[model samples]
Target chain A: MENTITSIFDMNIKPEYLFIHLDAVDNMDAIKQMAVNLAKQGVVKNSFIPAVLERERIFSTGLQFDETGIAIPHTDTQHINSSAISIAILKKPVTFQAMGMPDSKVNVEIIFMLAIKTAHGHIKFLQTLMNQLQNKVILHNLINSTSKKLLINNFKSLFNKEN
Target chain B: MKKILVACGAGVCTSTAVLNKLKSILDDRGFKGKYELSQCKVAEVPAKSSGYDLCIATTTVSEVKCPFIMGIPFLTGRGLDDVIKKILKELEK
Candidate 1:
């Protein structure tokens, strides 16, 4: 329902981001709690958990890449301030529902949380990110990134057209 | 002619996204055929008496019986290759 225009080509998202190094989270319940806590603290705003749960009520965000419990929870842009993204790294790993794989669970340790600001422009952001996700090289870099700075720089570089 | 049914919670938001993806994939494959797109609730798939060539449902269905292509990654790529293949197969039919 949001009408804001945050574009991937506009370079709206930056490395100045907020994140929770889930060096200890072990379950989806905890993941939900961290997101809820951020929402409560005004770090993410009111729509984070609602949007996440709602989209998930439809489907899951778990991508189960590398079979190491990593996934992304990207909701609609209605609950966004801008094109800000948050990353959550779980220490113990958690099981999340997969797209069509019902009985099988996708493990999630790393979450590239997307907070898009527009109803339409988010499609482009998703395409860009998903392209990288489909690439083994970029996925490996993301999985190996240890610091926030590293994650930011690498992602920015990937999105940086000249890179 | 084969049909691909797109279903979602309300048949509005994400179904639209999936529709966009299907259009692009079909166009890219150089196939010439019109696809039948039906948006419905997750609970409404079976009751509809249409033998769609392929069903692209964005969410989980209880006991629905059809070849369903999940759209979780119509928004991403990891789940997109198979989706493209399914749509292409339907187009070839």
Candidate 2:
């Protein structure tokens, strides 16, 4: 069995989980695709997909930034096996109900699907990611990165500076 | 000290982000040591809200005993000043 102690500290974002120029029909399609991929990677349980979909419906994750929009979709900790952040740069923007305002809509070009295994364990990473998201230059670079490798490099660099 | 509750869908991601941002904002605005922030799932708001002086959530919540503020501004950096003013106003009351 994988050492539980080591696994708990190994929640770094995996490159395989990063998707660039990903093609999806809509918000649900994007989330389902990412959730399914995370499940295959053993980062989340098979039940994560349905739970995330249901959660997204009730509490939308669409955040509209100054220059672009992004969505962070996630579910309960019970559906996750380990902690990971799966990022998708959509080939085309998809409509998602705005966070805290279901009546409004946002065309999200980036998706950050969070598979958190514990309640408060990943707060530092989450805070850093939020601060990065608030930076227009970083958000632009993330959306325009031509390749998955480039995107992951840029993404990792953002966190590297913080730590 | 004022008790502020920050909540999101799962209480893990967005709420954590909002809580940290809120804390820094409060600290910068000289609200240090004046309040305590707690994170929880949106589903747990109604039950946990009464103990708080304010409830800020990334999603819609109902039946909250304290004043409710939408925390999406903290994530998007839009209207954050207004939200902070609102939070300070609530904390003052």
Candidate 3:
């Protein structure tokens, strides 16, 4: 049981999943670009694209922090093969409907596309990510990271601190 | 004990994040062990919300039997204090 719990918390962000300064015209474009990469890597099923797009339309994941705005776009577990997070730092900000507020819009700069395999499996990781998001320094580091290695290192450091 | 229901699009990502933040806030505010939290998809809110003292969702939900709170601030880190105040007010009642 201890091993199971440890392995669950061992979720890693793959180096290949990190895209620096990704170019996209809109929110859907941004999501599609990242979703396609995950699909190519066999991280998620082909159905993930449509499922995530449809889900975003109804329940947006766009979050606007004080200085930076980010979005966590994800779909159901059925669309995932393995649990992974795809990070895309867009070349320019794209407009996304704010979560729980369809009338409001957020200009998102970073996108964290989550491909989760279970409902409650990554609670700790998600919590840690939320805490990191609240940190202006970390969010600044993430947004200004120009290299994939730097971004992945910054991300890995979060989990490292947790364990 | 106060019963809290938290829902997102798929009961996975955002809800889990919000639930974690809510737990820590409530725990700090002297609510530890005094409440229970359950996660579900937003579609289930109408049916599951009746039994909960508060329904917090990352998206808009309709026809919730309990008082509803928009949990986006927990994610964005904006207006979170106000949301926490609202939650404490609801749960304290």
Candidate 4:
């Protein structure tokens, strides 16, 4: 064995996991597409799609940011082979029911699909990412980045020293 | 210690993030040993909420029997101060 280990901050988001200017009619379609991509990449099992969609139907994931709207759709640990995050920047915003407010809706432009293998593991990484989401400059950079290389670099840069 | 319930969609991802953030805030305010944290799925909140002093969740929950707080502030860091204030007031009561 190589005996290599990875930290959540150091986890590499493969270029294949990044999708930009994607088109989806609604949150379900967007999530389905992202889950399909993750499955094809061998990041998640084929069951990830229905599990995630069902989770979202009961518990809304939409977050309306000061600059743009976003959603973090995720499910429990059973179907994941490893931990990975899939990024999808929609071509046009889709309506997603707001988190903690099922009746409310948000026009979400970005999606962070989380495939976590442990219930409590990698929480620090999520917190760090959430804090970065608060910064409009970073979200703007992510939204406008043209290539997968740039997008992955932008995400990694969020964990840089200054944070 | 008072029981504090923190739940999300599947009890996996965001709930833990929010729980960690909430713990740090409570620690800073001298709340150590003043409360105990429990993590659960949103679907379990209705049956379990009654035993907890307060419930904080990232997803919409129905039929919660205890006082509830919206956990989005902890995630986004927006209006966090107000959320903290509300938490403090609730804890005090």
TM-score, chain B, each candidate = 0.80, 0.97, 0.98, 0.97
Instruction: Report the C-alpha lDDT of model 1 over A10-97, residue by residue, as the tens digit.
Output: 4353333434356544445555665675565444667678667666645665665543545556565556555566666555567777
RMSD score of candidate 2 (Å): 3.5
What ordering of candidates by TM-score runs from best to worst? 3, 2, 4, 1
What does the lDDT read for residue A67 in candidate 4?
Answer: 77
| Model 4: per-residue Cα lDDT over A1-163, one tens digit each | 1222223553437778888888998889999999999999888999998999998897878998887889999887898988988899899999999888878898999999999987887877888888888999999999888877787778778878434
Backbone clashes under 3 angstroms, per model? 5, 0, 0, 0
TM-score of 3: 0.94
How high is the TM-score of chain A in model 3?
0.93
Candidate 2's displacement at residue A163, Å, is 1.4
What DockQ do you compute for every candidate structure?
0.32, 0.82, 0.80, 0.78
Tell me which residue pairs clash in candidate 4.
Answer: none
Model 2 DockQ, alpha carbons vs. true complex: 0.82
Task: List the candidate numbers ranked by lDDT, top first.
Answer: 3, 2, 4, 1
Model 4: how far residue A156 lies from native, Å: 0.5
State which candidate, 2 or 3, has the greater DockQ.
2
Deviating ranges (above 4 Å) for candidate 1:
A1-16, A37-44, A50-58, A66-69, A75-78, A81-83, A161-163, B1-21, B32-54, B62-67, B72-83
Listed in order, each prediction's TM-score against the native is 0.69, 0.93, 0.94, 0.92
Candidate closer to the true structure by DockQ (higher is better), 1 or 4: 4
Worst lDDT window (10 residues) for model 1 chain A? A1-10
TM-score of chain A of each: 0.72, 0.92, 0.93, 0.92
Q: Compare candidates 3 and 4 on DockQ and give the better one.
A: 3
